[model samples]
Target: MRPSTDIDPAIPLRARDGDVEAFAELVEFFHVRCLRYARYMLGEEEDAEEAVQDTFVRVYDHLGQFRPDARFEPWLFRILANRCRTVRERRRRRESLVTTGELPAVAAEAEGMSQDLLEEVEAALEELPAEQREAFLLRHVEDLSYEDMAVITGVRLSALRMRVKRACDTLRIRLKEER
Candidate 1:
């Protein structure tokens, strides 16, 4: 009997059978938040996209290894986060690192955001260290609890909290700088 915690039945079963389409469904499910996390951690669209792709490939290879008791999203995010780390290391080695591109041209302010506000948030995210950025994204963007963050990152819970705090402080300073 599958102990249910709200997973798509199609995913684990089909994925274990080497079904690429079922895996693609998983990718589609995670794509937006994964891209956001990759973008924030890697500081570039291309790198983020690559991280997401690499994550999916790794997921395919490791599908059979997934524990039945685990939450799929956080597990997948963990793989994505690790890939982002590797991508960042490679970019550092390459030494021609580029930050995320400018937001698409904003003709008019939407809701409560101005273009400058969007730019400031982007800039702050860009300045965060990779680990800090990953912590931030996992905590706030993905709304994962600190325990979940620890599970995903394989860090102690206290350490994950500290990383999240530092990330928040750094982002606050960066946003302050824009004032």
Candidate 2:
């Protein structure tokens, strides 16, 4: 489930107006989630960190371009998602063998979730197609509306829905089998 991660509506507006402290607040508010999402996407801490840093840098560079009428969550996530894709592509082009993935630090965020269960779920998530996994994470884990997801992913609402559905179905089966 997604956390209640909202910030003040004025934060982005303040940041866009060249408020350095506001921008810092924006970074602080989103850093953990951006890192977590990037980690899930890249499956490595270093890559995730790079993606998140790049994402914030880009966001700062382009804050003036952000539409004031729009919500900040989707816009921030859109940049993060793009950064993940870029980092993933770069990693892929390097063609290096990666034998390990970082354990999710957010595992403790889920109260009452067992370590074994978290590992099983992470393994199952890793087995999903990238598109499906991204869709599932954006929709479920990030608690984004389908419309927001469409803006972030550039995928049609139906396609995003289908991807999330397939991911959930696969996860259900995989988790059940693991148990």
Candidate 3:
């Protein structure tokens, strides 16, 4: 679940230069990770898929604006995060009063955990405040550095660290309560 370190440095440059094949390669490389992030954020498969599609479309359209000196992964994630927020806002507006008790299933399975423990973890994650959840996921799940997270989320570094710390504290308390 770490941020990919093997991304080709030339791919973003080629993509910016309007190389369709290069863009396709970027999509192929990033799609799964993007989908995973979107799903984790949005908590629904359909919404995640839509958000990722919209993210790619926006990426293609705005490729010209990408700065050559900047890292592409953070820039791409920024767009995807924005797309997820937009989708979430739209869903909130559309369904103002949803009352479902069913929790959104976690997409990733823990290798050595029992099903009950996994459920507890997923529920604990779901209970986090949205900002905390995003910060925690970007830091622990995606394994991005605080600087990279700040770049992607536009939050100050100290604030991001506080959010992540709060998230971890909340998760620990919640998981212990579950046990």
The best candidate in terms of lDDT = 2
lDDT tens digits by residue: candidate 1, 10-111: 586687787878887887777887887887777678898899988988888889888766678778878988898888888776432355566455542745
Model 2 residue runs over 4 Å out of place are 1-4, 93-110
Q: By summed lDDT, which 10 consecutive residues of candidate 3 come out lowest?
A: 95-104
Question: Where is the poorest 10-residue window by lDDT in model 2?
Answer: 94-103
Q: Report the number of clashing residue pairs per model.
A: 0, 0, 0
Ranking by TM-score: 2, 3, 1
In model 3, the Cα lDDT at residue 121 comes to 75
Q: What's model 3's lDDT at 93?
A: 50
Off by over 4 Å in 3: 1-6, 93-110
Error of 2 at 54 (Å): 0.4
Q: Write the per-residue lDDT of candidate 2 for residues 15-38, one digit (tens) a residue.
A: 999999999999898898888788
User: For model 1, what is the C-alpha lDDT against the true structure?
Assistant: 0.77
**Clashing residue pairs, candidate 2?**
none
> What lDDT does candidate 2 reach at residue 26?
91
Which model scores highest in TM-score?
A: 2
Clashing pairs in 3: none
Residue 90 of model 3, lDDT score: 81
